[model samples]
Target: MASEQMPPVVTLHEEYGCGAREIGERVAASLGVEYVGRAMKSETIDEIAGDADEGGFVERFLRSFTPIPSHDANIAWALEAHADHEVADQNNRYLADLAQDGAVIHGRAGAHVLADRPATLHVKLIAPLSTRITRAATEAGITPERARHRQAREDRVRTDFCRRLYRWDPRENDRFDLVVNTASFTPEQAADLIVTTYRLHFPV
Candidate 1:
């Protein structure tokens, strides 16, 4: 008999305040696998375009493609459509390379990047806006009003980025193998659920 095949990549797409980072970290730790998410995505951008400031290349890239006003109120940043496409291409390449390690990738269009791969498992996490706002407020040490405002801004930016780059909404349930509402479950529970699901598909 042949040895069992290793599991495919696990990709997580989530709203800004949905606790994906926490849950993904837990899942990666439990599985003894690597966790690749925003930080990795940022590093990829810096590698491709060179560093500049705090936000740097990735920040500009996201802002350029954002359909609405960006976080920076004073400086309006915009890139040509082709430039946006190039950045997105670089992101896809980076994600593909990372997924080869059979890791849990937490966002930046990872699901779409690995969509064609046979072993890839894509998940999406969502929550009620109020719940997300409270979580964001608690995490950031900010008031609920402030957190709510920030959440709305982030939602617009992320939604617009996906729409402009991938021609699809990340919130669409059809794109994911599993959709969990973080409002109903703690991060630990969410992580356990994901791990259980993965084991069901790819047993050790």
Candidate 2:
């Protein structure tokens, strides 16, 4: 539903320590659009749940994360599945609303949520394990060994987030309009490349 008058939307998905947030900020600045980070989307969800206390998404989403007795295992599983779908639907609507104007969204499954929107670019950033571990360690001021462990945990969580909610595997390169290996480019350079591609697809 995008029009020529509206600015383009950009979604960037990256592995841990790939500088997704910084790159997304740069892209947003260059395009003069709002930059929506993963934390912002999560906060929005929390706010929604808080505003609507009971008999709504709050109870279902919370139930998805809590344990139930053995006697209610089947019922719990069903509720969990329903909760996952509800969250996905909410996320999609939120992203769609943002894309109506134009936004550079970092993480929170932006790529999957806005895949069908016109004048939108879907980007993914990746690097080898060694490269990412080194970057993560330097950024967090932690040892490479600890960074590696954190990377494994975070990667699993992100992959599962996409797979469980959207049934989309982000590792599939075909899903992205542009896939950059961040090991080869600085964050600014990556942002430049993405902006160039965006302009090409959605000329101003």
Candidate 3:
């Protein structure tokens, strides 16, 4: 394959509790490139996990278990709340900046946000709940049940944010070019596949 055809950008969105982060890292390593996550780019998670008065704070503060009437309403609320972080400008800027470079970007709607870019290979990483629970427990050094709860909390918050802001479920299938199940494949195998695909589709 020629370099011009190679994909210059790659993005992965994973379900919470999935080993997406680790796998993203490995894939970037295999490709000799960068790996980035939304957490790395924004402090929203830290603020939300802490005592900040971020947007949707009051509502989410009440209880994550409270279900919105529809996923779209929740995504709208999350976008509205995103202003609290004062990161919207930064987010757009960074998304534009990312177009100048390629990396293993983990979250913060990197795929959808950077859709204008022509060379990105979008991927979604998913795994069974059991795989996620075990991965989180082993990595976080917590019990399985506790890990499950924590994973669910994190997943819910992120999903809620996406639903409210984009009217799109993070788990939806349309946003990705390739979807990998980590439960069935080793991270290295996943990385190998991504790299191979990159070489095939993105000869740049």
Candidate 4:
């Protein structure tokens, strides 16, 4: 149990292609805690364009371009997706056990894992699909068109994982204590806002 006067812990859930990673970084920096988006992303997301030996991202399982032409193909895809989900679930459990109270954990279903902790503040980071696609494109230095393709694929897998595991709809607004629309603010500006908001709720 927490001391009654302690501030709430913070959990940041981010949509694909959003700038939540950077914002999470700045918020953690402002509040003097560890930032965590990359730890989760690098462990789960496969590096599509990098060397196999390099650890840019690890693949939980394969993703295919060939169509799921039949019922069997669909089944195979679902099994693969499930395998990945299991791996992610294990990681999330480890994350929860390792997290110190009051740490701002970004992603890795940190919100759900830390739900039992009193005064936990859950935040959702989102933007218009176009805005997020642009951000992903710029980060990858790819054309917006290609970015859209990648974003769609990422979004589908992510949505499936969350829904399958926790029955949580990432699109639902009510799940979060604070939801930030990243499209309107610069990354730095958004970060500042989050930091300010978090501080207001957790004055020391």
Q: Highest TM-score, which number?
A: 2
Candidate 2 per-residue lDDT, tens place, 12-72, comes to: 9888778787899999999989999874332344454454533354343444455344468
Superposed Cα deviation of residue 98, candidate 4 (Å): 3.8
lDDT of 3: 0.68
Clashing pairs in 4: none
Listed in order, each prediction's TM-score against the native is 0.77, 0.82, 0.75, 0.71
Better of 2 and 3 by TM-score: 2
Clashing pairs in 1: none
Tens digits of per-residue lDDT, candidate 1, 1-204, equal 211365457899888678888899998888777988764332244354443533234455554444434456443334345556776898888887776666889877777777877666788989998889888788778889868766655666566667777887887877798998999999999999988887786676
Clashes of each: 0, 0, 13, 0
Candidate order by lDDT, decreasing, is: 2, 1, 3, 4
lDDT of 1 at 90: 83
lDDT of 3 at 37: 67
Candidate 1: stretches off by over 4 Å: 1-4, 39-79
Most accurate candidate by lDDT:
2
Query: Which residue segments of model 3 deviate by more than 4 Å?
Result: 1-7, 40-86
In model 1, which range of ten residues has the least summed lDDT?
39-48
Question: What lDDT is reached at residue 63 by model 2?
Answer: 48
